[model samples]
Target: MSDCILEMRGITKEFPGVKALNNVHLRVKAGEIHALCGENGAGKSTLMKVLSGVYPHGTYTGDILYQGNVCRFKNIKQSEEAGIVIIHQELALVPQLSIAENLFLGNEQAQKGVIDWRKTKLETLELMKKVGLAEPADTLVSQIGVGKQQLVEIAKALAKKVRLLILDEPTAALNEDDSENLLNLLLELKKQGITSIMISHKLNEITKIADSITVLRDGQTIETLDVQGGELTENRIIKGMVGRELQNRYPERHAEIGEVIFEVKEWNVHHPLRPDRKVVSDANLSVRKGEIAGIAGLMGSGRTELAMSIFGKSYGKNISGTLIKDGRQLNIRHAGDAIQNGIVYVTEDRKGNGLILMDNIKGNITLSKLNKVASGLVMDERREKHEAERFRRKLNIKTPDIYQTTGNLSGGNQQKVMLSKWIFAEPDILILDEPTRGIDVGAKYEIYGIINQLAEEGKAVIIISSELPELLGMCDRIYTMCEGELTAEFSKEDASQETLMKYMTNRIKKGGEAYADTGANG
Candidate 1:
């Protein structure tokens, strides 16, 4: 195209034991949002790194043509200087710093070795406004929500005068409104002549904002399509990514509902920091003896908070709940107390809260229930190894041995370890939040199989998912929360994307009342 702004031709990248990228070709027109689509480990990140100069010219074989001339980027700094900025999937803001400070961290507004505080704040406010952030620049990053933090990231990129912005899963953690806002911001940026490259698993989002789409699979470029004139659909994009038509994004599971085993009534959770604020309001939910109940919502809709608060109040303050297991109410005020009562929650944040990353699989699995293998103060190391080995096989965790550190494993394998840890606790009620997020399709299938098996085993499984397909496919019943309230309840037969999203955004009414759901269920 005559409007081509950036191009990579014959790009090849290799690791010692793997070919990360294979002659991948990509072209982007000026002021167009180019979506990079791929499954995890499909060389998308590797290609971006190479383009952004994380891999220097000597390390990768490629020719980058920006604005028609050939160029080689030596480092991230050089790339930024050339008006290319990348915001990583994991946000890069200093939590303790003010928004202004983070926006101009290394590139401070200084004159004669003196920082210009007034000018910095003024510029930060303008930049934040450009990205649709309404907050004051002096606000600390930690004080704001994740969606706002994402805006700050954009503002930082804008501060660098980025013409080509690369976003890796920018809206993965965003709620419906926030995600919409981010997409609208991208559209606005496009109008301002800023070209964007977005890499995401949310195909619907890609369809809405991207002007063109490129598919990368198994370290190779498949095809690129112009998304204008309704040329791109989710099914087509998925076919390109997975290399085959996925009959359904959500794998089907036949449900065999049984008697109710786990029940919560009138549960209430207060904000962890601001005790006066309710995070989860009065809510009532139940999971059957052999059924999967799904809690669906946008980010910050109290889905994860509900799971965490109910799990020994591990996440929220001023928590009060009546947990009824087998028609008997039990007090579960601590993590150990919940575990003893046959309840376990596998957190969404596996790397941070779920696993002892530096430790081996055996150590992490047994760490949850050391009392089972403990003789007095010391655990019987032999028995622990035997138990870990048993689950490693049962769960199909692809580790060389139970002794290998968990951090070295893939995201999917690490998730398996987290599950193994909870399963060892022998819980009757198991809560899984974002269980299959950021994993490959094959891994997602394995995780789904495990969930199905758990349901078959008569565990009361409560699955909280960002992906609607997962909830629709695996859940016997679905509960959708918006803001801080449960707005809709649907039997699996009645649920659809539209209905679920209606509740998820607080658009639907439940029990003749419209309310923002604070996840209070007992």
Candidate 2:
């Protein structure tokens, strides 16, 4: 009998003009945690899709072996029936549905073609206990937080009698405590003899839990290292993913900050749903020409809400603020008004708010600034193509051509397209919210380089990020926020992780908030 629980050989998947995966191979031992590591668009997810029957049997060229026997899976249901279940990054749970309903969505507790409500709730409660979920089975999935939602997803998998589990970027959006809890649950699962395959960009978690790590780059398998063989390190894994030794995770840059060009003063925003609740309180900040300023905050500190409200009141109600551009005060009413005033906000929710995913790359890139390629209300095809192709090369976006669908592109490339859309709008002040979220280290370095280039061009830049290290590495100045209030400010020379955390957690500290000396600083 073979020692491996699963084996995939010679897997090759192709899309229109794109070979997403080529001759990729993977092996998973029973009751061991396997990790798949790669740069964006390097075929990690594609390979998992093949294994989970998302691509079906005839759509791809591959051989799958489960339990020492060749198996042909026709769909996700077939794979699930054989004890294989995959939990995607963007969860598949229905928000309004109860936990019991979500857990046994397709596979329900039924008798005579009618769902048995009592049996479904009972089994759901048991599954929830196993996954460390405390919510009642009758609780609505939407009423719970994201961290809890993750647990519900695991419980759903457990209900399916999943033997080999696949999780893609499981902790990408989770906070520190929630992430630790999920990792611990995985460890507990491993001890219980449930094999797992996790795809993640977080090397720390992978090193801690993964028994074996497989590295893939550009649709080809590079190497797989056994953790038990020796002590594995993130640096070693990074080399295999990028095929080079990266001395610094962030690109080096020198600051050439000039006079402030954009500023917000006495900014306040109220919760849209809760009229009396203030989400952002008396916020004041500014950004100068050639300066990269950063906002460091924990989740729900109102950083995103502030940025959106200031960018034409797209987020909150009862908005009160003063916007100054080039020392002149202006009233910006909507997104178009903000853009006309030479300001653009690149949303953190890139897929939902940033890009038209169904549109081609060329169309999405040029959508923000169509006036540049228009002649009397008609778009010029040649001009649009030329502009799109220019950004594709300048940003080094990995795509076959500009005509490819934006939705099909990887996270990194999609982010690049979003940046291109705003850059083409010729904005003087650019606000980036989690610009490097969900991308690999190599792609992050590339994005940092682009931000540096933008700064070098004398554009004012504002960055909001969850990672403290990224802010320390890229920003010339950093401001910490806590509970919808600006708590502290630190120059690059004085800022450290320790100091930032102090302010980040002290929401009620006396005299915490600090505004810029001039009316024009972000």
Candidate 3:
């Protein structure tokens, strides 16, 4: 028998109206990276929560064995005491505190009554060095980037003497370089005999790092794949995730480019807090009727800032832009004006700004277009439900019903509700910023189909994405932005990963000509 560090046998967990996990079995060997994969609502996180004692003892039916000893932990503290630590998808770090403080937050270095600041700082430095973070221990967590913050999280785990670490979507928010560094760090940890269980939606990352993959579908374990034996592909994983073969990752689209419908000329936006700093430079972009346009750039390249500034004056201060719609220049000062003028923006931060998590799906979907379901300033509850039901069906939003809370829905379904909220508002031009940020592959294809349907309906769609492949696959024309400026534009036939990266990194100086590689015609 293999030296299994952890084994969860016949685990079954249930919520009030949902069966999250059903007799799920997972076995992880010592010092190996075990990957757990599933669709958005496929019980991956729930299982991890149960294992880490977030559900506690007697709440779920299961037997958890760690190193051949059956363990029943009552709380997170108990689990941590047993050398099990879970770093959640949403980071749990106090932004106001220093790295040393966050590293020893719950478990502080103290003697009887007071904390030993000197010892805490010294230990934090050691942990930081172990994680390859070169920052000072006194540095505030907010001062560091997302990549550095992730390292701090791991350091915190190490502080607890974690033997089996569970990471939920660790690289979901990281850029390519940061993600690579984090993955390499995980390998180093494995060499030091630390076991890891990773839950991820990024199939490519899983294929590259995972020694063994355990797939789940609808709260049931599908199969455990030994990737070390070879012949494990993303397509095979997708089949196990969705329970069906996905013929293509991106849906087929027939483009019908028409005359220019919307255009932005000499658009400039200053930073919200620091008016002296310009976030978006004098940029020009346009979209035609029935066209799918894409904005491609590295993170912090002013792509999201540009979209928000155009949607309303929602992002920056001292905005100067000429918005042309159907040969008419319109001044949009607020969100209401933008919506009334047939322009809607689907925000990238769906959990933060897009939807009301506390409210039900019916409420969120009808929020943007409440007037449609209102009678003389009074909401028609029946009409609202009818309208919400229509969108739920149209978008294929999976839930028990439209009455389910938006927060409880999976990432893909929550995104669908966000789209429904905007689409119901009846916008001619839709600006989608990172629409499919943290969703599964099966859901991505569904969203692409929705985009295609919108294009077929002659709506102008602009997608801003960090994924180069997504932009290339979905857009008819792609624009590359770098350092707050538009660097290059390419049609579908002309764009590729390499060509887009060239423009994305090749920055143009202030008041300087375009790069020499991209000629006057380009």
Candidate 4:
């Protein structure tokens, strides 16, 4: 008689040195959107993995009841057969495959073990229509944008006849418009009687869509709030997740800004693959010592491209620019050169381009500056450990030890390790791209404090973020980019979300001209 479609009771999962989940309980109603919220390492993902059979039944002590029947799944396939499917944050689609091919990868529409092309295409179209994806079945997944890719993922889940869908950080990488569309699609799915459990760090989205919310903290369930009961609020959720009153989302900082120490003038870059297409155009910006500068833009507005191209021409082809540091022209050709000249870029793609996940924390922390922990071509293990342990404590990394593999650490801890690596390089100018992209509010506040500390130490810091509130809160000055052009600049006092968004979406036309006239120097 209970309306719960899925119930996980007394789940306890442990690893070699960490108890990832302890007595965690979750219940998803028949056709409601349930949100799972917590800090970085709070066992949200681990519990979901157990439910989807990634950890398997025997690997953990738990009881899973699906539709009032005891379910013991041995693997992902068994769970899928039982109508439970999990779509991970890192999408599982093959880039080279067509949309139809990726959708029916393992669960193919076939006759005698061979694919039925006509039937496959027809089903693919139907599935796409359900998720509001209008892409052709023959179109390569690589050819579509990230928004379209997410739709493909959903359509794939639909193909499996998913009764209970679990999504991990679904909108973490999506832009605003794409995130809205995806959230709307989930509502549509709910109307069709599909139950969903969403694990996300975006509290606003949770408050907007989740019917029931379960908060987890440090491997244990804290509390669950009902949206219909008016018990769901961002502040209340934050209090549960962090076990305290957050007070202020951004830390207080007193900046002692000095003269401009770094400047890029008349910068232009062409796309790496398409030489005729420009990615960054006539961009001019400057950062002073003890100042946190921010670049605001929509996705594909060339924010990341500008940052990467400046960090020793690591991106784009036919790059033409003048880099000035402390009133002197500097020529930098590569990342090593940029580092040598006291400039470092912490990449937005932490997993793909920043950290070596398989390596230990100590290895990743000392990777960027091995010589600092080296004794004449030999690595000093003691020094490396000492350095890594220092940063771990300084950043409150929440790891068992520095010897733990980076892959096992949570998203926030992995990001801290990435920052520690670049911080160890002893750079005078630090550029962070999407520094808090997938991080929770507590983790984001900690990162903001770290940036404040860097500014206090007289290091010029530049942040590139899609979240306007983050930039408004943390930056001493903000720059808006639109269509590969630096459109406008505003001091901290003048920068508001509305104004920044207007420039970000290219609503104001004269801002670009004003920026060209004054530049960052003005």
Candidate 5:
């Protein structure tokens, strides 16, 4: 127990055109929760993968020391066998399978190649009890919410006899109550003598649980800090992560708010899967030109659904909404109508819904309006390439040419491509959904600049984000939502995460006492 449980010396990993990790060093002691902190794509995940053998030994230049001895793990199974398990941010659980089945997926309770269902159920129940999850063991993973699915992942780790567990952004999607529950569970695991490594962007959560903190920047490890005994402050952790004193995470912007350019009146959208259930309830919101209005809410809070429903009725059914643009009522029947009406939605998912990964950079940029690239029917290749090239340089897509496939680019570049697609469509009102999600600090800054430029040009910008700090920073005004209802409105001067969250959470219970995340918005 006195020895270091895990150590990686001079670990390095490289991808095409990028060095994912560069000569990094990290160590975790027995029963210690060592937090790995960095912005997105800062090699925190890459270094962990190297230690866990997601990248085979021969692929990276490093030595992994486990439990006072050097270990060569060729695969994830071998690492798990050595009492190591990694729970990725994107959970690997099978949605269709029962929790018990997922827990013992590879290592099942079987004799003569037949599973012992009775024994599996009992074992799963015990594991669930350890994690304090109240769900039945036989419930399908898809039927439960994200928070419960996370517990199942932990249970799976426990089933493998894990000694050191790695959790990547475990609570990124969880609500406040769920996030607190997960953090408490980690402390409980620590009490049981289990060591853990957590990679997260939420500095608040990290400060609450981490024993020691390791900061990584651009594939290199910053000096590790011992944060026990009230030494860990948000200021210190942020300085280490960003490598500079941030006067304000949100950039300075004096609002030049004017008349509302876009407004949604009596908007109600039913659930796409279940039309009888309302996803957005008579939501009324407005964005003024040259002003950034933010929508802040937890996941499944109908923020995205509201945006999608308003953007050409692409999201929900039984949609009863009146959209007004430039002080005139506009009927948006479909996505194309939404675009033609100068309304565009940048989806939260870049790889899944936003961009054509297989297409070249130019193709993606011009995909929204090919008719403009031609006189009548045929797409003029020269004009298409020129349009792609222009936005590629304008948005700083970082590719040599517009011919590059979007899939080959980095996450930030892919996001930029997604943005470029919407910008090329020439929409007057742009709704960005999680625009800076999974992007690094540098990229986020660039994105902020782009957003400012968009607003400065007198376009209406509506930002939807789970990160409260971002809304406080980028948005001139903020709107709070909970349980599919629009609850509170805030001005930047009077807004903070605490004030905003209060309204966001308080709205959960039917018209209960109104509170703000920080305080009253002046």
Candidate 6:
């Protein structure tokens, strides 16, 4: 018997003005963790969709052999029946449903069109235990954190008797601890003889867990490398994914930092839902013109809360803050006021809160400031197209034209569009939260270059990132946040990953002084 459990030959898929996949091939051995690596829009997700029946059998020309038999699946149901299941980046669980209800949504434990609640709960518990999830079966999906919710998804897959499991960017939204747990679970599942395929942009995680890796670029197969051979490294994988050796992960920048351009003093924000709970407290930070400042903290450390609250109180309740721009205190009441005062915030949740996915690139790019491309109450389509085209070229957004739908573009392109929108607003202070999250190394390099260019243009940029190395590489000054308080501050010359992490995890007591003085007014 052959060891190969799955093989895709000569797969070709296309759409209007786009050849998403062209003559792609993939082979996955039985009971081995196979990783699919590529830059954004490199046909990774499209190939998976074709195999899982999202595009159906006839929509694409391909040969799929599963378990020594040719499989022509016309829908996801047929694929699932054949023991092939795909979990998307955006989880499919219903937030309002209970754990048990979500697990057996389509495949219920029932008799005579009536559900057996007792049997469902018992089986749910068994599945939960298998995935190391300790939550009760009656618990609502929304009640659990993202990590537990991911486990619920896996338990659901196990319930279907899944033989070949596929996951797309599983840990993109998870923190360090949750990501570690999920990767460990995958290793455990491999021990149980389950075949898995994981698609991820995280090169570090891929190198750690993948038994074999297949690199794809520009909608075609590059090469498959054996991890056991002891020759495969992150640099080698990068060569295959981007078709060249990237000498530096971060682009070089000549920072010309000037006098203080923006300052936030004694900023405090309470939770909107729970008014008594403070989300950000006694924060003091300053950014100089032509400087890139960074906020380094672990997940749930109030970095985003602080940025949002500072940006016209978009988040939190009972916000009290002093915003000084160029030595003048401003009273900003809303997002519009912030924009008018030349302050813009680029949200981390780009898909959820940043862009209108349905709108085209031209609309999204010019959406932030309509006055730039409008006369009185009427929009100038020609001027709008000109501005959008200019930014698309400026950012090197990979697309056929400015009329393409924003949702159809890749993750990296979507982020560029979001940046273009804010840049069009002509902001003096830019707060970018997770600017390079979920993007490949090539895209990250481009984004860092863009940030450098913005700073070169004399904008005061504040970055909030989960990746410590990114902050260390790009920021001229870095501040550490812990439990809603500014714990410490360090200059780029004095900061390292180890030093930043120490202060990030340092818990600050209430009414206590910061570990280090920020050297700014409070």
What is the model-wide C-alpha lDDT for candidate 2? 0.91
> Whose TM-score is greatest here?
4
Which residue ranges in model 1 land beyond 4 Å of their true spot?
9-18, 69-71, 359-367, 370-410, 440-443, 482-488, 496-509, 512-522
Candidate 6 structure, TM-score to reference? 0.97
Question: Candidate 2: misplaced stretches above 4 Å?
Answer: 509-522
Give a tens-digit lDDT track for model 4, residues 317-416. Answer: 9999899999999999998999999999999999999999999999999999999999999999899889999999999897889989999998888999
Q: How close to the true structure is residue 404 of candidate 4, measured as C-alpha lDDT?
A: 92
- How well is each residue in 1-522 modelled by candidate 2, as lDDT tens digits? 667999999999998888999999999999999999999999999999999999999999989999888888999999999999999999999999998999999999999999999999889989999988888888999999888899999989998999999999999888777899999999999998899999999888899989999999999999999987897889999999999999998888988999989988999999999979999998888788999999998888999999999889999999997999999998999999999999999998889999999999999999987899999899999999999999999999989899999999999999999999999999999999999988898899999999999999999999999888899999998888999998777788778999888888887542533733322233
Candidate 6, residues 62-134: lDDT per residue as tens digits? 7999998998999999999999999999899999999999999999999999999999999999999999988
lDDT of 1 by residue, 370-414 (tens): 998889998898899899999999999976688888876767789
Task: Output the better candidate (1/4) by TM-score.
Answer: 4
Indicate the worst ten consecutive residues by lDDT in candidate 4: 509-518
C-alpha lDDT score of every prediction, in listed order: 0.86, 0.91, 0.92, 0.92, 0.86, 0.93
What TM-score would you give candidate 4 relative to the actual structure?
0.98
Error of 2 at 288 (Å): 1.4
- Weakest lDDT window of 10 consecutive positions for candidate 1: 513-522
Go through the candidates in order and give the C-alpha RMSD of each one to the true structure. 3.9, 2.0, 1.9, 1.4, 3.4, 1.8
lDDT, candidate 4, at 470: 93
For 25-129, candidate 3 gives per-residue lDDT tens digits of 999999999999999999999999999999998999989999889999999999999999999989999999999999999999999979999999899999999
| Residue pair clashes in candidate 2 | 285-522, 286-521, 286-522, 287-522
The Cα error of candidate 4 at residue 502, in Å, is 1.0
The runs of at least 3 residues in candidate 3 whose Cα sits more than 4 Å from the true structure, single-residue gaps closed, are: 509-522
TM-score between model 5 and native:
0.90
Q: Candidate 6: which pairs clash?
A: none
Candidate 2 TM-score, true structure as reference: 0.97
lDDT of 6 at 16: 86
